[model samples]
Target: MDVWPSLREAAARVDDLVAALPAPGARSAAQRAELGTARDAARTLRVRYLDAHAEMLYERLTAGTQGLRLEELVEAAGAGYPSVVPTAAQLESDRGRRQADKEGHEIDQGIFLSAVLRSPSAGPHLLDTMLRPTPRALELLPEFTRTGVLRTRSVLLERRDGAAYLTLCRDDCLNAEDEAQVDDMETAVDLALLDPRVEVGVVRGGEMSHPRYRGRRVFSAGINLKCLEAGDITLTGFLLRRELGYIHKLVRGVLTDRPGSWHSRTVEKPWIAAVDTFAIGGGAQLLLVFDHVLAAADAYVSLPAAREGIVPGAANFRLGRHTGPRISRQVILHGRRIHAAEPDARLVLDEVVEPGAMDAAIAAAVERLRSPAVVANRRMLNTAEESQDEFRRYMSEFALQQALRLYGEDVIAKAGRFAGRSG
Candidate 1:
């Protein structure tokens, strides 16, 4: 039996069910039951569709059509039936399947790398790949270095005592990221890693310049909700630029030592996050990837993406590694706030110091950690903690779920509410 036709029929049924369901207010028992039934059926159909889609992609990959673009293939796969054939639900399902496939590919590549490293002849080729930028990374360099938008620098790179400090300087929005800031940040990270003079790296938020947060420091407020509310950033752009581009790049850069490749690297410089005031949403997510975190006593952290109706980038993968699964779930699902003084905060933060003493504490930490032995130990610890296979799997899952949440209806509604408030 042809599965594509059946998948299309299932998708149509899901669309019909969604149309029949009661509108967004409180629902009666019968309405709730009907909605639940529809959701269950849709979920099952979505899984089947995803599996078939994966099979089709595999066929294409094995049939000497590796030149075909992934997005184009996905689009071609869904080119049948009505406008609602590839609904939000189906798209999300497809994303998950694609992510899994990507993880598998990366794992195979990593196995190849390991084999090459072990070989007497191919080890130099692996190092060359690490030292140079791949074609895809080169394509993204324009986004990283293009300047002319904002007068002030969003990311400031400073060198002190053999350490490179990349400060988030967008105090106007409490260090909330815009496109320029994201680009600058990616550039700063790249420069820091490539600079041989830099032995260690520190990332911190600057003192707020806005009236609302005057004289105070903030790590970041995550994505600039004002931009989202203003429709300056569409759902597609948010997924591609912010989630996949900026946040993903920063996390991968810190965790993986290499300049290129999505797979985690065996050698990476240790990174420290010196968070002050508040680390909300994307800011808080950044802390998860850092090797160590030092927060001011008054600083508080939260993954407010739940409130914003979106997924916090990479937080789903790394939060549980810092905090336990329970706390991570609460923070992600319930918008739980963790203050520096709280015991649970210790999971993510290595130390909590007096508000005015954060800089000194960070300096001391950097002084102690900026050594060749420390770098080697860090790489060893990272390898022991999680393999490249595990990292690839987590990132793949994160990319899919984050993309779906960014483009989902709930986030759109939340953005509308934010726009209303700003207006």
Candidate 2:
């Protein structure tokens, strides 16, 4: 079927609706109506594209790429399609039923997630990607082999005594992550996880060098709302980059020991989080995956995503494991703030140390966790706790819900009000 023409027409309708809106932050009933219309058109466009591409991907996966090279497959699929064609090496590496399973699983995830975002179906697709044994090729890939220091503006990576310290350093905004910072953090985590010199990894927020912060450390204030308010980052962009690209990568790395790809080997190292001050929104969400959490006495954690009208990445899936279903619902649905001093905070935080002694506490914890026995135990625990199928299911739902809420007129209006208050 010739779907491109319909896609183009839908795009044009969306463009027309957008062009009718007033300037950013200038809210009006007319502008709200225009945005709602644009959102509807965008969703329709997304559904059309996803449906067509889903069929194409399924065919490609099932038909075995017809022995075509990766670039050739891309050419065959034609332009304006999804750009997730597997590499020649990836295709060649698959052998027999394993090949079908690998390719089919990847394609299924891609299409299932696409459909979820385009529509609202929470049911899981039947795929054995999670239940199957790890592929031999993936197992053979080097786990941790970094040869040199990794540098980044937003994160500081230091290796000492078989542990790598990854400190979030954007204290000027209390380590609030913008797109670049998110990219930097992801890179830092990857480097630390892959470095053979590192056996365990620790993530913490750095003490602010800015005068206003008075040398205090902050875990994170969450996504850079200022950038969002300035229209520098669209809600879709933030969801894709910060949520899917950044935090999701970290969560996958921690839980499955694998990076965000199916082809990568799992890193065997355990990760620890040291939270100081407050971990708000995405910050608290990040802590949910850590094997151990050490928080300062003054620190408090919150998932204010409900208030902000966004989904906290992976928190819904993993937070329940730590905080139980009821409290997880309360923290997420009711926007409850959890202070380190609260008994419920113990569900998430392993320890709460004196505010000024977090460094010493983390140091001791790190030293104690350096034993081979501890590593083995941690790995066993991780194997028991992590579920790839569950993670994939939660993420699909999150992507859909987050997109709807983030782009909805009500949420945009709420964000604008927040921007006004902050300004």
Q: Pick the candidate with the highest TM-score.
A: 2
Worst 10 residues of 2 by lDDT: 125-134
lDDT of 2 at 313: 69
How displaced is residue 279 in candidate 2, in Å?
A: 0.7
Candidate 2 structure quality by residue, lDDT tens digits, 307-372: 777677678878998988999999999999999998999999999999878889888888877777
TM-score of each: 0.65, 0.71
Runs in model 2 lying further than 4 Å from the true structure:
1-55, 58-113, 116-148, 209-212, 234-238, 243-264, 373-380, 420-423
Candidate 2 colliding pairs? 144-194
RMSD of 2: 10.2
* Maximum-lDDT candidate: 2
